[model samples]
Target: MEGIKRIYLLIGQKGSGKSFIGTLMEKEFGIKFIRVEDWAKKIKKDRNVDSEAYLKQVFEENENEIRDSLTDMDKIVFESTGLTEHFDIMLESLRRDFKES
Candidate 1:
């Protein structure tokens, strides 16, 4: 698979402008914007359960989806609160796999 040309990570606190920037990027640059929190919320609702374990599982699934997208996508954007072990692990994996990027 081809490496992604660009990966934009928007890390910020709640009520910040990360989401705004992500939206702008998607609309203006045609980049794929991934909002992890929204996806996590959807997963929680679908499962009808609440637990850190399940949240972590959802995070891992999202990470895998992002990694998989590196094949066909040239650019991608991600919005996160910039906390959690899962985020750290995902960053490490991205660094390892896309060292050139």
Candidate 2:
């Protein structure tokens, strides 16, 4: 099997153009773009919860989905704010999924 490669994680503060950069990368490199907040919102809608605990749960659940999707793709661009405490989790997920090419 071909080893996974070409994973890019755009980390920065909110409104810092990470998503825009990811969009450009997607167009230029034919990579998939995974936006974490959008995923979290989808999960939240499904769970139908407005509490802090529920939001946290939604984020965690969606993060796993995002990670799994990234792991199986050849090229993926993940855009997120790097200020989160769970940033390490995102980095480790990418590192574990793809080898530098």
Candidate 3:
């Protein structure tokens, strides 16, 4: 079975070009790019919950979904806002997963 060989976590302030870099990676190198905020948006839309109150839950679910989708992928990039304390859980999970890879 194929597994991830490389992981890029793009961490920076908001309005920086992390997502742009991720997009460039996706387009130029065919690496899979996972944007956490996009996942949060989808989760909010699907669950109809308050994001501020349920951010941890949303991020946990996002991490789970990202992990589940990693099978057969070799390179992946995650675009994240490096400003939230709550995001640490997901970041740690990603680090664990990438280390295992």
Candidate 4:
């Protein structure tokens, strides 16, 4: 069997089952899940802002981590609201990494 690293971008509105899907993916694929909100808190140490700014910083930081992980991990699940510019930036960064890799 061939092994490939995957970076899943879960995009959905509130209460749209993003978390549920992430959990399912983790169980079914044995992939590690990285939630943007939790990552932002760990990265920035601030949780008082609204989702918009939080997600932006998360994307910026998470994208770098994702790129780094791709070299070692089999799969990484990026769980996010996917409704902000930050998400788009992260996606673009992922694409660039894919091309470079």
Candidate topping TM-score: 1
* Model 3 CA RMSD to the hidden true structure, in angstroms: 3.1
Tell me how many clashing residue pairs each candidate has: 0, 0, 0, 0
RMSD of each: 2.6, 3.6, 3.1, 3.6
lDDT of 1 by residue, 11-45 (tens): 99988999899999999999888888777876786
Evaluate all candidate structures by whole-model CA lDDT and list the values in order.
Answer: 0.79, 0.69, 0.76, 0.74
TM-score per prediction, in order, is 0.83, 0.68, 0.77, 0.74
Q: Is candidate 1 or candidate 2 better by TM-score?
A: 1
Candidate 3 per-residue C-alpha lDDT over 12-98 given as tens digits, one digit per residue, 9 for 90 to 100: 888899999999999999988888888777767556444565687767876776676676676778877756666787778778757
The C-alpha stretches of model 1 lying farther than 4 A from their native spots are 1-4, 46-50
Candidate 4 TM-score, true structure as reference: 0.74
Ranking by lDDT: 1, 3, 4, 2
Residue 95 local lDDT, model 4 = 82
Clashing pairs in 3: none
User: What tens digits encode model 4's per-residue C-alpha lDDT throughout 1-101?
Assistant: 64666777777787888888888888998877777667766856646556677667777888878777777887888777777777787788678656434
Could you give candidate 2's per-residue lDDT for residues 2-76 as a string of tens digits?
655666778788889999988898898878887877866766654654565665554566557665665677667
Which of 1 and 4 is ahead in TM-score?
A: 1
Error of model 4, residue 94, in angstroms: 0.8
10 residues in a row with least lDDT, candidate 1: 45-54
- Displacement of residue 98 (Cα, Å) in model 2 is 3.4
Q: What does candidate 1 score on TM?
A: 0.83
Report how far off residue 21 is in candidate 4 (Å): 1.4
Model 4 has an lDDT value of: 0.74
**Candidate 4: regions farther than 4 A off:** 1-3, 43-48, 51-55, 99-101
